[model samples]
Target chain A: MLTAQSTKQFKFINIDRVALIAAAAGLLSTFAAGFVTFKPNRIAAGEAFSLAASVPLQGFLAFLALWILVALLSISGIRLEKQAVFTSICGGSLLLLTFFLAGQYATAATLEHGSISRISPGTGMWIMVFAEVVLLLNAVQRGGERTRFVTALSAATVAGFVFLLLTGHLNDISIMKEYFNRQDRFFSEFKVHLLLATSSVGAATLLGIPLGILALKKKSLDAPTFFTLNILQTIPSLALFGILIPLLAYLSARYSLIREIGVQGIGWAPAVTALTLYSILPIARNTYAGFATVDPGALDAGLGMGMTRTQLLMKVEIPIASPVILNGIRIALVQAIGLTAVAALIGAGGFGVFIFQGLGQAAVDLILLGAIPTILLAVAADGITNWCIAVIQPRGIR
Target chain B: MIELVNVTKEYPGTVAVKDLTFEVGDGEFCVLIGPSGCGKSTTLRMINRLIEATSGTLLIDGTDIRDYRPEELRRKIGYAIQSVGLFPHMTVAQNISVVPGLLKWETSRIDKRVGELLDLFGLDPSAYKGKYPRELSGGEAQRVGVARALAADPSILLMDEPFGALDPITRESLQNEFSRIQRGLKKTIVFVTHDIDEAIRLAARILIMREGELVQYDTPENILTSPGDKFVLEFIGTDRALKRLARLPVQGLMRSALSVVLSDDPGKVEKSLAENSYLWVTDNEGRLKGWLDRKVLDKAPFNMEDSIVRIRVADFAVSPDSTAKEALSKMVLAGTSSAPVVDNTDLLVGEIRLADLLEA
Candidate 1:
């Protein structure tokens, strides 16, 4: 069934079949499942409700408009060669619509049952979220201005959603209720989470970068350093945290100065220490790989041009290796963000408090309150660092 | 001036260069040429102390090279390589000014030097100064590499197959430009290449090396006329006569042309044409306008204002800057024994005869 013209046209169209299939599947499942769940109170299990039963007429119409827009955009993409910008715009619009409808549905449910009823988004809404993400990823693969477009779209979505929250349009939702109940605690936990992630990545960078450079310069150290880091990487996050606790306890007990400085068996000290150890592997590995792959010709030229060893490293090798090194830092940053949530188990005091508490109470909404922001934080970190890497890459190489 | 006496470089398993001796006079363009693994590159590197001589004395300006710090010695010896090895991140001006900047030269001095070097390499300073290496054509980047090497105004230059990566046409043009630049500056240069043709074209003295040893060192003409051994003869190839022609320029052999102005009396023009088969006709500025054939003039009415036998110079003309071989080919293509040579202004300079080219 293949022909030269068909293949040529396919290349020109640049259609992503995976995204198309996912969107179609998501649309089909939306009709088959409940769009939202209604509960009598924050403590009660919710009952599933279809979109027609929950959302207002305007909300439904907006959803329909979004669907039509997505289809039109995709069809136009098939007819044109440059479609990344259009696809990303469509994906961003869909994301905004999904959030708008959820807020509207919550508002509508609250109007009907007042403060007694609690509203939560259902499987249909989650499916749409997954579909939009896949579509955005497809646009990203096409490159060009797509990343910038998507980033702008995400910023707008976050701003609009925050505006709705500030205006108390969705105050009736169970997660919002959970948030209102512990507003001060929630902010403190977010701060702790951010601090834990950043400080650990900072420490990892300080230790790993030098080790990476040394490993590159001294060939004898490369194998042993990588082997140890690889073993550390293979350890489970929780197990690593557990292993750190006793070692820190012994150290704190052995030294009166350590105890005076608040180094203990548990808390931020052990949590940050474990996180830093976990972060070192990615930073070290990427730094080594970056330096190892520098064009040998450039090094030879630098040396032949009378550059001293330090001068060559500073001017030629480091600048060439920086983008790759930053890429490694990006991986470490995102990983550290996710791991900090687990660090809450050691009383490190982050959003993980909500997750564990929700588990004890069997409250899915509380768990989502902790989980959603964590995902968004990781995504934002990834986007920002990827932009940095792209910007710092040498113009000639690019 | 550079002198290497019994210099040797040994690696873990094999000797790279062994017991080499040579002296390059000041302002000489000395080229080291050989097959791969023949130690030509090693010899050049040793001179700059990039690769230290294991057991010998290498002298520059009559001072032993070992007494100077490698970095200090290298800073005084400009180096360029085959890949050009231009810093990808730096602009053309920045790349050219690297050494000057390192030596803490004033900003104005570096800027003026960059402009001068760009102009010297035939690259327009305003157009190419801000461009990155990636934005340049291969030839332009190679020129920038050479410009960067020459930035410090070092008396000695070391080039390693600097034009090896360019296309043949680009390589030929670069060679011509380099020869022009070398004539003006007269820097002491040590060039290394695997190409004998390049060595012959640019080097005042050619040092041909075999595996770890110097096989011959002499002037290009001497090498062509009397190769040191069978290896040297075979390596120069069988086209020695053609190559020797390539070495001679048309300007060196061109003779004054017999030309008559259009304003000259037709009787006098005809008389001049009788001596030669064809006489070149020129305008008031000595530009070649056409030619007068004796046979055609014989049948004409011979009126000054009306009739004359004439053919446009475009039909049979060469440039004064062309090689003698190029002039000979042009003459053969035009089916003429001689052709007029013009300068860039289109003014007739002289004539080139097929016999003169053959004799050269």
Candidate 2:
């Protein structure tokens, strides 16, 4: 039979868990708002505005309210609620801050018509404001029941304030609405850009890892392959794109094969190819780093125990070096996202569309439409990647 | 039984082990020992084919071990290293069950074997079965390593400096416990270490190596009494006599002349004294009390029937396993020429004298 205390502990559990639940629910709400058509009377882009404005605002505000409550509770010295509240506040706030800063640039240029970026600071704010509470809870759980609640609460409050920024929903949030209203046509284009950027990064990882392993295992292959990759990395992105344009045109004209394969210019394909080319360094470099770092003695031990070469690689070396490789992959992923945004300049479909189109039309709000999500996407990609790394690293290492 | 004939291992610059020849008899506790870089480890590793011997004919149970697949040979020969290479990801039980599990035993059988091995090593299966290697103390982890080696019941066991990292007290106790386990199991064992005392204590036949060559291979008593060369003699050093004491039992040097005194009655004398000038007094059931004053008989007719005065608990003697160095140190510190010796029941065994200790 579980006691009430135990039940409460089960509920409160880890702040990250609570933050996960809150953030997940918040993301789901955002997703729902994206799908549903809403009606806002007397709005320009009438049906589109009705479908977009209030639903995202309401969902964003709800998410914001959760973080605000978490921040307030953390500030008020309530320890029990600190972890979920603090992590949500801190982690969410940092994410929100990142989004806000990126949104400021996006809106100033008119890529968006409204302050969607400024709307919800997200769980990052809550997580940041009450980080101490989360740490305190961790300590109490580890240290035993003799610990005072106040110690944890105060610790949570203190940790939350570590990354404090006084500005919130002040200048940028107000400007956000005006920015979105001006660039109403570009929001949907931004989504496709994000999808292509992410998928291409994933595609780069798939190709890079096996090549890395082969280079590591075969010495004869290592130098030549590495030189080729180094040369590839050294080529300027703009030059690479310029080179690809002719290559793509030749393939499309000569073969009549590329069109069926979705190789259209001013579309997803070229953007993905460009972004993927930018991603190889982190993956290949990390893979090499990971394999090189495996202890020779540990390898010897496995081999001495009669492990086959393949078995040794799979069972010992790979498991031990996974974190390093993952770190490399993460770096590649971030770089890819940033570079992919540049693909929009070439009319490759993405958030880049709004920025390029806005620049052409001299509409700052349209530029904001594309640039804001790109920045937000980068932050989201980073947070999710970091979380994944944290999860993937063997508990044994820590 | 295992045999190594003319085994030599040559590396790029130097030979790691050279022309080593020895035989581990059935159920024999053979120990290989030497200072670092002496190729003792190189020799131990070669037996399991971890390192290929430059030239040798190795036999296990009178068959060439090299003929068997290395993995197959290892499966049949339990091997443990100095660092206790337990898989960090596995639980204690899982670590122990590795070899047996590798043998493809049924899950229930493997579980039973794990339980038995843990219990044999004094680790409760229920308490420690699910614990990771990091959770264990240094001593406990080493014990688990030994348990894991024994899991498949391989007739041949190889242990490489198993207790090398432990503190002296723990090392001693574990040595004794492992010796007891070995005595019961009687598995043909080849233990390796740099610690000469450990070699002497654990080995039935000790082989000393130096710079990849077999320097001396003999019984512990023979090695100490007559070292083969300057290297062997210098290795044992001036501590030869102390090392000799380690081989002898406590019964060989305990004090016998104990003066008895009464606990309840202080002044009376009708005690039995033939050639004994002193008596070791006891309260009840041979529990030690301080010795009676032998000269008190001259002053008054005193009987130590009831009254006993404990001058100090340190003044009396203890068990036989207490080493000569310890007994000698206690004697010098207590300023006593003699000390009584007793067993676990507190029954008087003998007396330890300065002369007796010096003789030892």
For all predictions in the order shown, the interface RMSD in Å is: 1.3, 2.7
- Cα error, residue A242 of model 1, in Å, equals 6.3
TM-score, chain B, each candidate: 0.91, 0.90
Q: Cα lDDT of model 2 overall? A: 0.68
Q: Name the runs in model 1 displaced over 4 angstroms.
A: A1-33, A66-117, A128-154, A181-185, A214-278, A343-349, B258-318, B328-340, B345-348, B354-359
**lDDT (C-alpha) at residue A375 in model 2:** 78
Worst 10 residues of 2 chain B by lDDT: B261-270
Q: What is the per-residue lDDT of model 2 for residues A328-372, given as tens digits with 9 covering 90 to 100?
A: 777877777677767766667666766777678664445666676
lDDT (10s digit) by residue, model 1, range A1-398: 98998887774554556556655855654564577888888778778876666667776666666655565556654532245566566677777677777787787778888876788878877787788777767666664645676556655756766887788876767789889888899999999999999999999999999999899989999999999999998999899989999999999999999999998989999999988998999999999988987777777877888889898888878888899889999999999999999998998978888898888888888998898888888998999999899988877667
| Tens digit per residue, CA lDDT, model 1, B100-196 | 8778899999999999999999999999998998899999999999999999999999999999999999999999999999999999999999988
Clashes of 2: 86
